[model samples]
Target chain A: AAFLVAPLQAADPLPSWNDGTTKQSIVDFVNKVTEEGSGDFVPVAERIAVFDNDGTLWSENPLPFQVIFAAAEIKRLLPEHPEWNDNAAVQAFIKSDVAALTANHNKGLLEVLALTHAGMSTDAYDQRVKDWLATAEHPRWKKPYSQCVYQPMIELLEYLRANDFQTWIVSGGGLSFMRVLSEQTYGIPPQQVIGSHGQATFEMKDGVPTLTKTLETVFVDDKAGKPAGIYQFIGRRPIAAFGNSDGDQAMLEYTTIDNPRPSFGMIIHHTDAEREYAYDAKPKSSGKLITALEAAPTHGWTVVDMKKDWETVLAE
Target chain B: AAFLVAPLQAADPLPSWNDGTTKQSIVDFVNKVTEEGSGDFVPVAERIAVFDNDGTLWSENPLPFQVIFAAAEIKRLLPEHPEWNDNAAVQAFIKSDVAALTANHNKGLLEVLALTHAGMSTDAYDQRVKDWLATAEHPRWKKPYSQCVYQPMIELLEYLRANDFQTWIVSGGGLSFMRVLSEQTYGIPPQQVIGSHGQATFEMKDGVPTLTKTLETVFVDDKAGKPAGIYQFIGRRPIAAFGNSDGDQAMLEYTTIDNPRPSFGMIIHHTDAEREYAYDAKPKSSGKLITALEAAPTHGWTVVDMKKDWETVLAE
Candidate 1:
């Protein structure tokens, strides 16, 4: 007599995702585009998936992490620079006056950025960001900010990579800032991260080459600029786009609309206040999801409700 | 029963390269950087190698291929617009008067490019380039322009790739034009090709997303700008750089000068007058190697003698 046993089933690629329509949709889309002989199959070279960094991949409740870092940098550097104390905008920022900080079309924000982000060598700036992330902890969780990345999204990134897709981070954050953490937190390398960029001058300083950041006109990578950035950097239209805010609306449209390949668009709806912060139209900083949320249904985008779709919040 | 057999020495990775110091240097550098226990070993992610496209990778004798394409386009589009007939620059270009076309800092050249390069959707421009390449032949070789690419360089690209190094093209050619042939000719993807970039606007035309190329301030990827382009696009500093002219001096410097990891720099001296063209200090178009050639020895940059080192010129 012989006993028959079924071969072990393949392990779940997205263990953090709940076994529901949302999870099934992601799996189905990957299978449709990746499996050989499928009608919707896309070649591996064209299999690009772009994700917005701030709210989609990580928590951005009170402020985007970069902004928080900037604020912290201001405090840390204030003692050495007494000239900043005379500026009213700097005083308002020090007092935590949100309205004052945002007033005058963010003149104060620009000033703060010029102070913290520019006037240093890029290597020095990279070191500063790395050091801050190593020490800085989220106020609410009391854990490193890098540890607050979404578990489901991280798994999704890995799953797409496993299927021979190139995962890219298209963010509104500073290119230098996002690149420092992206490879460690999301497995996305620096070359694959596209973000808002400013002018950097290259020169040889004392026989050593150096790149210094400058307070030049920054190319903002939000809203319609996202699509422009994509065209300039990637040189190919992505097959899938994921975002959680209005800033990413153009990118989503650019990804899915009239794409020759079968494409996908997903919106991460922060509906779980218990597990994570919830906001859509009115966010404390950065994300505002009204336009993208309203357009999602018409575009056939899957709206992922955090409460219903994700088994876990932060990456383990 | 065992028959004594020698393991077939792995097929020559760079077979088009002659058995000489130049070829051996490349193989030795790759081995030193890729071997597991070597002190100079670099991680695969950090092993970036950049190459110049025009003279370094292919034959840029009378003019760079893109300039030739532009000249062809001027003639092709001239009949459509009578106003262009009134323009002196257009007439000079049509007559192939090099001195007149280059007068006033290549004012005629710029005029030709504006008419041929801008005022179309990027998609339309891409299709036009593809159509031109498919039909156009090099006047010297009487073959498709793509076939003029150097065989030794192609093999070098493959050899580096086999060693897990990412090869990138940082050229002075138009970004979109270089991207069309880069993948098929060099086995490099569009994302890895960085070049001169013009502003493109994203908009919806007839409910279809479109990117219209504009005659704006183009960021030239030449001379000092090469390193800037690499910084903006690739983020990480390259470990190896290859070029054929003075325009690439900054990039060569940025790549090898005090790089954290072991680095290599090579300049291809155009000396094969019979097989290709031989002009360094006084080239007919684009590439001019004087300052870089003088500086190479002090920098320890290997200068390649094209006639002696390359067993084959054009890709077979």
Candidate 2:
């Protein structure tokens, strides 16, 4: 004589995602990997999922948010150095012309960053970045930049974590810049962040231990650098990866195509002009989703069309 | 009326640690922070503890184990390049005189590492290290180096983790070298390890993504570099720090001294010659405990006397 035992109700794993194949694929992949005694079941320790920061998690549109922050930094420092205007790139950025900076394929952006972000102790620079993030707002959204993070992806990050995946942010964004808001915004702590970085020399200035930030490019984590960064930091190939652009193509290829595990790759396509912005293989889009968009079919990557796949773009 | 119930039995947290102030202090600190409705309670997420690898967690003498691995690597690579014998350092290392290498104060050791360990893909190097560990045995103990791990510290790590503290290893050892065995040896995964690293370039080899190791010295996580490495990798300041040498002094200072938390710093003093090799404040010792030995008392740091505090050293 056995009494019927009621099972605990499972909440929506991804509350913001619409009922579609993109969401269903993600759910199926997670289920297959997590089910104990199943053929595709992966141990919890190997359940690693990496995410590209700029476009995948938040709006990198208009431009990647760090670019805007660097431009603003240039504007802030412009009053001290009148000679900065003589530089064509600096002048172009100050005038609010995104194409002038983007025209050089991020060379101008790197130059702007070098001019504004180096030559200070990491602590001092941390304070400055903290100050900027406190007041910085997106131009089109008219809200704080942190608030512009996609609500659907936030749910996804939590969902992956709930499924025993150690979620990480593998970004092309400056390590210092993203570290400021990563923990608070995405629930991914700083230790879990792997990104592009500038060189810093460890020295004792006035007998006080300090890490002096230098203007040297040590690692630029984009395109091919993504896989390298992952190996250097995580030391294991991720079981899953998510990104939105060709810059993330190397990471996606490394994750889904190479690893022996039952892995997942995803690309968030900005196909909703009214909700977000629709730009793929276009001239003006910051996150140019071209190679990844074209290769998604062959790799079994889930391409999430923002308009149809996301029930909510941003949290109210 | 309520029936009286016996309190749940508490498991002994440090079975390897003898009943003394050293063991008592650890229990007191953990209790203060974890006690519910207590004034000193710290949230579980902020409970970070960092341990220096070599002497703190395992044996560093007769030498730090990684250096032994590197010397062995030099010998293995000698057959490929006959001309390397011309170099005084390589010739000295081949002779197996630890004094010949240590006399140069890590400069010669670094040369040995760059010559033998670099120029291969990280994956290849990882496999080589893995292969070496599988066959290699400690010279003095006649056991695998992985078996030399301190039993008391293992208990401490488990005790901390059970209480929600995330433990990390900020070692002066080679990053790739330590990662091969960290998960199996210490229960700390590769991603939790922050150590010295050399530069590597990312390139596709016949359409396969590979990271080619280079000879360039990118970072050395020692002395002041420990704090800097912690900052670069973890981003957040740890609340608990442990070490056994002067090399870890800065990390302890950065973690316990600077951060505004109820932090703890403990130094593992090598004073047991009967059960284990004991050498601190000596010229020949690689993990020097001189400066840190003197600074411990002033910082309210706990000094674990190996002979007195531990009932056993290695795991049974």
Candidate 3:
């Protein structure tokens, strides 16, 4: 909340952003909304910007990072869960059998998620996640997951924050998982990272109090859940929303297609096969860009073609 | 984020806090954590201070302010729910029958809470709550609930913020309810307010999306739930915590009883019956200074006796 008095630099806040309408729109909107005495000028407190984590801020290609982490964690914990030896899916995961995991993907994924995340004290689980992140790398890129963030988007986060907007991450991924990396990667603090959460129980362990996670999903923040999560976590509607998938459709609608206030919503079109993976109209059950993409034109949402608009992708 | 650089005022930030050991302890703790080269220096990101809302920040006497609002909300919505006429507790509530409402308090209170809070879209409920707050007054004080906040605690909140600490409210009140008033009443924003929450469902109503409240307690942020809720909402452990009740015991213990960083846990002893209301060791379930009170001396918590420690109660 404290910023030293410094003159605004002539240098662009979003250096990674290419010279395009996609970037121009953001700069123009921010300038318009922040100009004092202008009709569009918003108070500092109401300048909330929400960004979806999975693809909007970083790459979620191949599979969501949390899913990847869950699979790896299942492999690591397989030695402890000896009873799962009879299960084909568990064996497939342990053996890195993608075919079997895909065959029983739902069942397999559920076991991995439940076994790896639940049943531990939150403090212990945080340490486990921290340990995992220190060593975990993306399957295709082989880079640390933390460094997989989009440089352009990272610039955007700093730019918005510098202009007095509090940037938040609204994701369908586990809240616990996203919180661990939000501050480190995005400069968005843990409190501002609202996502799906599971039920937790409080108990005393040897005279010390601790909260243990349960397998039950308390909230699944996706699709419509995005807006719901935003509403729950932040009473004020975000004036700016960014996302890359159909999961963020409602949030974008809630932001730009709103009844009141000047708002902006943008979708990062993952259309670069060279720099990054490209797939928007994905298979069944994927939050394919069909609905959101189709409606983007009328809502005035900026759909950034990654191949054309981005000068660079990864932070590196 | 936009505050002009000014020299730190030599005047005390907490003028309402009388010169005493309790006030000095708070000052010392903050200085130790914030001074750059100090052994206990905590980074600005780790300077999180949590406060229990009801009695800690304001007066919760005569009934928690939320319960009072719920009772009033029940009266306002009774016309729509004409069947409530058959309920004696509802009738007593309507006629101000303290005996009847108190006798069947649990069931009656549940009905009031469910009828008033559940079944409405969060936006509509927020509006309803806002409207009620715009007009409602504390039954005893005959003043707005927002105006009843403690002057000393308000100073403490601002003081901590000025010292580079992020302040959060961890309350047992409805998250939605507290959020509606938090920003307006306290400097804390809705995102910084963590409290008990009810289950809500995301749905589309007439082509517009809305999150509807459900009649289920997802998490109750009292007692053990305090620490659990803190861990859920704010993954970082709080370095400083303040409360006025036994319900806050677990949180105080979690924050300051035993931890790595230099932490401070302080309790506001409501021992000024003349100025406010004095009732410690409150019957079985109140925020009676019992478990927390007993543990404070050994844990080095600063217990503030309102009559002696505060120059004034409500901010003038």
For model 1, the DockQ equals 0.68
Candidate 2, residues B1-316: lDDT per residue as tens digits? 1333434556698999999899998999998889878877888878989999898899887778887787788878788989887987898787767777767566777778878678899888988888778888988788888888899999999999999999999988888888889899889999989888876767757867678887674688888888878877887778889999899888877776645668899999988988887878883547778888898888888999999999999875
TM-score of 1: 0.97
Q: Please list the residue runs of candidate 3 whose C-alpha ends up more than 4 Å from where it truly belongs after superposition.
A: A1-9, A95-105, A283-287, B1-9, B95-105, B283-286
Better of 1 and 2 by lDDT: 1
Per-candidate clashes, comma-separated: 0, 0, 0
Q: Which candidate is the best by lDDT?
A: 1
- lDDT (10s digit) by residue, model 3, range B228-287: 788777778899999998899889988975588999999999888888888788632246
TM-scores for every predicted model: 0.97, 0.93, 0.93
Clashing pairs in 2: none
Model 2 CAPRI quality = acceptable
Worst window of 10 by summed lDDT in candidate 2 chain B: B1-10
Deviating ranges (above 4 Å) for candidate 1: A1-7, B1-7
> Is model 1 an incorrect, acceptable, medium or high docking prediction?
medium
Tell how far residue A307 is off in model 3, in angstroms.
0.4
Q: What does candidate 2's lDDT look like per residue over A106-206, in tens digits?
A: 67776788887788888888888788888988888888888889999999999999988999999988887788889989999988898888767666556
User: B164, model 3: CA deviation in Å?
Assistant: 1.4
